[model samples]
Structure formats: structure tokens, C-alpha cells
Target chain A: MKNALQTVLALLGEDYDSILQAWLETQKAEGVRRPDLFSDRESRRQLGDILRGLGEGISRSDLSEGIALDADSWTDLRATLDEVTQERVERGVSPSEMATFILAMKQPVFARLRERLAADPTRLIEEITQFSRVVDALAMHTNEHFIEARDQVIERQRAEMMELSTPVVQLWDRVLTIPLIGTLDSMRAQEVMENLLNAIVEHSAEVVIVDITGVRVVDTQVAQHLLRTAAAVRLMGAEAIISGISPKIAQTMVELGVDVGEVTTRPTIRAALAHAFRRVGFSIEKVENARG
Target chain B: MADTASVYLVEHVLLVAIPDNITDTEIMSLQEELSTRIVSDGARGVVIDIAALEIVDTFVGRVLAQLSSMARLLAAETFVVGMRPAVAMTLVELGMDLHGSRTALTLSHALRALRSEGLA
Candidate 1:
């Protein structure tokens, strides 16, 4: 078994350029390679690094010891795998293609071992089985790493959207306006309320106009969230005026029996702003054109 | 702890400054003292200066709300002033807004609001 692995490692160390070329061809034949997404220079450098790392890693591992990616010898291999996975995830590479990239190397390595040890069938089988196990573990590792990188990207985007979704703008000395858009889940609702309350305190706002014209739907859960936000605004000693209650939403609320209690709802944002101006003691009058 | 929340007469309004390290017993005693002074001192309003309080949990929020109503029953208005932004957010999140309890940005604002309402 040792002799068989020694021959395979020797072939890996001496002729990786040919093996890597063969690996790329196999992946292309399987229709997993994306030449459009990857420049030739980048593809060669990335695959070349992995081939080097794997050769160094397998040289220190015992063939019968099973897969130990945590082993000191596999450090280079693990690091290379991590880099490739992160790059692929950022480039929008399909996960199946990532896993297949590692798996395709098996065909090239097996062919190299066959040509060197085909005179002895038992040795060829030993090398083939040992090399297969190593490739399978590496493939599985690549799949998991890709998933982790993708999860991180999703988590960051969600955080960014949360920040962008809730913005409290101070429209007047003691008045703030929040124009809400999109769906209002419970978590997002909580975020909105927290941001509004903090802004009220920051600006010492006495009245706040929560405009929901951009909201597409007003389900029962959404109504509850809006009500809770209104209650929170009042609790902060600021008056809440819900504006832009579309006719459809009004009907839905009435049908759902969702009572807004003391929350003042207006027909449009203009009306709500007018009410806010009134609460803050701002009277607007249209002057006749003096030029006329 | 018992004397952490101090109530004193400022003009016709009773000004109460609650400390951050005030204990539950201190709050109960303070409430008793405040109620007594509202009648005895003939104050038209009570100004709770909670700027000294760093954290206002549900207990403090509910207490302020109850105190407001109790003061109203005794012919006096209660105003909580100088509430920190974080404390206000926590009160709202806890679903306790100290409803019926008026709030002001500063001690002077609470006093002015209280006095204006007294005249009205």
C-alpha cells in the first residue's frame, strides 16, 4: 500500500502540470467549467495552487489514517480550499460546479497512477482507492466551505437592508416623518419602532407622521405591527399620525376588525403633514400673487 | 437607598430627583412622600426628574404611569422630564409608555407645561 501511494505521490509531484490540464478538460467535458466567468490566467493560478497544496498535504498523511483536514500537513490544502471557495462564492459560481472542480481531479490522478503501475493490478487498485477517498473528502470540504461563504454574504446583505429600511427624518423642529416601504415583518417592525423612538428623543419631536403609502399590503400581522409602533410612539410622549391609508387597506382593516384605537389615520401624506403642522402650531396660508 | 429619590418643593411644583441606584423600598417611600407633599404643600403639579436615572425598566415605567394617575386623582398633574433616549426605547419595547403621564424634554419645559395646564 505504501509503495503504491509513493508512486502516485511521485507522479503528482513531477507531472502536476499535465494532470491539472487533464483535470480542466474533464471538468469541461462534464459541462461544469465556466470559461465565461473565469479568465484563463485566474483559472490556471487557482487550480495550480490547489494542486500544489494537495501534493504537499497527501505526502505527510498516512494512507490508512483516513481524512484529517485538521492535521498539520493539510494546513496548506485547507487554506487554498478556503480561498477558492470564497472567490467562487463572490463570483456567483454554482455550488455544484465548485464540488465538481475538486472531484474532476480524480480522473487525472488515476490515469497517471494507471500508466505508472498498470503492470501490477493490485498496486493500481490500492492507489486508486486511496486517492479516491482523499478526493471525496476534499470535495465535501469544498461544498461546506462554499455554503459557509454564501451564508456570510446573505447575513451581511440582510443587515444592510435592515439599516436601509428604517430611516427617521426630522421634517420640522419638533416633527419627524417616517416613510415606510415593503413588507413589515415582526423583526423589521421592531427595528422601525426602535429607530423612530430614538429619533423622537434625539429631535425632541412632539409629533411623528408614519407614512405607509409605499406599503403594498396590510395583513392582520402588519396591522398589529403598525398599532404597536403607534403605541410605542405615544409611550415616548410623541403623538403618532398614520398616513396614506389607501382605500384597499382601509377596507382590509375594517374587514379584519383591526381597530387602530387612538391612532389618527389620514387619507394622504399631505393631510397627515397638515395635521402635524397644526399640532406643532404651524399655519400655512396661500398668499395672492402680488405681481398680478 | 431609601433617601436616594429626593422630593423637594420648587415654587408650587414638587420636584423629585430619582437616583440611578434607588431601591424598590426607596421608590415606594418616595411615592408615599410625594403623594403626601402634593396635598400638604399645595403644589399644582409634580415634576419627576429622572435624568439621574440611567435605566428605566418596566417597573419604573409602570410606577411613573401609576403615579401620574394617582397624582391626577389628588388634583395634581405629574410630568416626567429628561428621559434618556435609550430609557424611552426600552419602555416602549416593554409595552409600557407611562401612558397618562406627561413627558418633557427638560425640567423647565415640564414646569411650564404643568403651570400652563394649571391655569387652563
Candidate 2:
């Protein structure tokens, strides 16, 4: 019981350079090393950072805490893993590929430990178990962080998409338009209503044309969201005019008994704008003598 | 948050100031009490001041709309005023329409609208 973790630390500390070299070679042998994706200097730097953090972590950790390393004592190790995983996830590297980088380190370190502990089989088993557990923990930790980072990336992208889909345009001095371009899910519907209402208040808009031309279909839920948006506008003392109702959508609306409720509907944005202009008391007229 | 309906009769108008948190039972009783007050007192208009309310869910929204409709049936106009922007947004997302109810930005505006509509 010579403290397997401390022994591994000594082994790693004494020949850190060679262990990194062996680790890099093992990565290349496993066909996971992509020099094109990561330069030799970058890979070497990451390995150096990992080895340094591992050494520092092992020194601070209490091995009697069993195979599980104390999470608080491994802050640097966690940081390194987070950084590596975040970059890899952003770069479109697969989880397995990211895990491979950490797991590949095991071969070199194990080979070194086996050679050094060849004289004693019981100590060898203990040391191998201790070393493999550390590697597995690090690999598993990296995978977990990678998944979290990927989910964060996805969530951010979804928010960005919601904002992009619900663009509020100022069509006139006191008239704004929101042209929804996708399926109106509850989340997107909320986003649409908030953006449209804020715009209405900001402009003191008298008329708002909600153009759903780009929207795919009008289900009961979608109709409800539209009605809600219009109702909010009316509540704000502004008239909400829905435009771009296709014949099919209109039929669907009638069938579903969906009521737009005192809000005017137009077949197109142009017609809605005309109606908006009329509602705001700005009638368009054709001037004479441009036909020469 | 007050359980009893805090209704004030101001110049032939039922002035109802809704609190921040009201239960369904309270809302129902409020509706009953206001309708009775409107009829018995000969109130010509109602101005619902929802400024104290931060959030209005579907039930509250439906209740507000229904209250206005009830007032209309009694020949009294209803003006719902002081709706916070956030509350309005929540109401819209919940698909609550204050049907045939006039909305004003402020209590003064509500009174003015009722006056202009010839209800007061």
C-alpha cells in the first residue's frame, strides 16, 4: 500500500516529457490524432497543460478518498477539461473523438507504470487499477462536459433562431409589421408576442400588420397565438391587422372556428399596408400624367 | 390580496382596483358584487384599475373580459386601464381577449374614454 496515486504522480513527474511523447504517439497510432485539425504545437501544448494539471491535482488530492478524486481539489483539471471540450464541441469534433484524446493518454502512462512495477504483481495490479480509474474519470468527465457544451450551443442557436424568425419591421411612422416565418410553437409564439408588443409600445403604433405569409400552417394552437397577439395589441389601444392568409389557411381557420376578433384580415402584406394606411387616415391616391 | 371587494362608487362609475394576488373564488365574488353594485347604484360606467396586478393569467383575463361584457349588458360601459406592459404580454400569450371592452393606458384615460363614449 505505497499509495498508488502518489507513486503514479512520481512516475509522471520524473519522465513527463517522455510520457507526453508516448501519449502523442499513441494518439497517432489510434488514428484519432488529426494534425490538420490541430497543429503539433497545439496538441503538444494541450498535453502539457493536462499533464501539469494532473500533477498539481494529484498532489492536492487525498487518495484515501478512494478511487474518486476530490472534485474541489481538481479545479485545474476541470478547467482544462472544460476548455478542451468547449473548443472541441465548437469545432464539431465528435464526443468519441474528444474522449479518445483523454483515453489515449492511458496507453503510454500504463506502459510506463507496468515496466516500473514489473517486480511486484500485487502492487502492479493496485497501481494499474488506480491509474486506469483516474484516466476513466477524466475521460468520463470530459464526455460529460462535452455534452453540456453541445447542449448550450444548441440552446443558444435556438434562441438566435427564435429572434431571427420574429423580426418586427417599422412599415410606417406609427405602423409596424411582424412577418412570422415558421411553425408557431409556444416558445416562439411567446417571443413573437413580446417583440411585437414591445415594438407597438415603442412606436405608439396605431396599426400593426401581422403577416403570416411565411408561416407554414395555421393550426388551432397557432390561431390561438395569433388571436392572443392581436388581443394584446388591442389591449395596448392599437389595432392589429393580420395579413397573408392563404386560401388554404383561411379554410383551416373557418373549419377550426378560429376567430381573429375585430382584427382585420388581409390576403397579402400589400393589402394589409393599404388597410393600415386607411386606418391611420393616410389614403393613397394616383396622380395624373405620368403615362407620357 | 384583500379578500373583500374594494369597490368605490365615483360619480355613477364603479371603480374596482384589483389587488396583486386574487383567488378564483375572490374573482367570482368580485364579479357578483360589482354586477350588483352596478345595478343597485345605477352606475353608468366601470373603470377596472389593474395597475396593482403584475400578472394576469387566462382565468383573470377571462374574468375581466366577462365583467366588461356583463357591464355592457347592464347598459354600463367598462374601461380596463393600467395594464402593465409585462402583464399585457402575458395576457396575449395566454390568448385572453377582453372582447368588446375598451382599454386605456391610465385611469384618467379610462375616465376620459368613458366620458367620450357618453357612458359617464
CAPRI accuracy category, model 2 = acceptable
lDDT of 1: 0.84
User: Which tens-of-lDDT digit does each residue in A176-195 have in candidate 1?
Assistant: 99999998888988889889
Model 1, which residues run further than 4 Å from truth? Answer: A1-3, A25-31, A35-37, A65-72, A114-122, A216-221, A281-292, B1-3, B8-12, B35-42, B54-62, B73-75, B84-96, B108-120
Q: Evaluate fnat for each of the predicted models and list the values in order.
A: 0.33, 0.44
Compared with the true structure, what per-residue lDDT tens digits does model 2 show for residues A3-117?
5576688877999999999999989988778787788998898889899989888777766656454478788988987897787788788888888989999888888878888
Poorest stretch of ten by lDDT in candidate 2 chain A: A61-70
The best candidate by TM-score is: 1
Q: What TM-score does each model's chain B reach against the true chain B?
A: 0.92, 0.92
Q: Which pairs of residues collide in candidate 1?
A: none
Compared with the true structure, all predictions reach lDDT values of: 0.84, 0.84
iRMSD in angstroms, per model: 2.4, 2.1
Give lDDT tens digits, candidate 1, residues B42-112: 98888898887778777777788888998999888888877776676677668886778877767777776
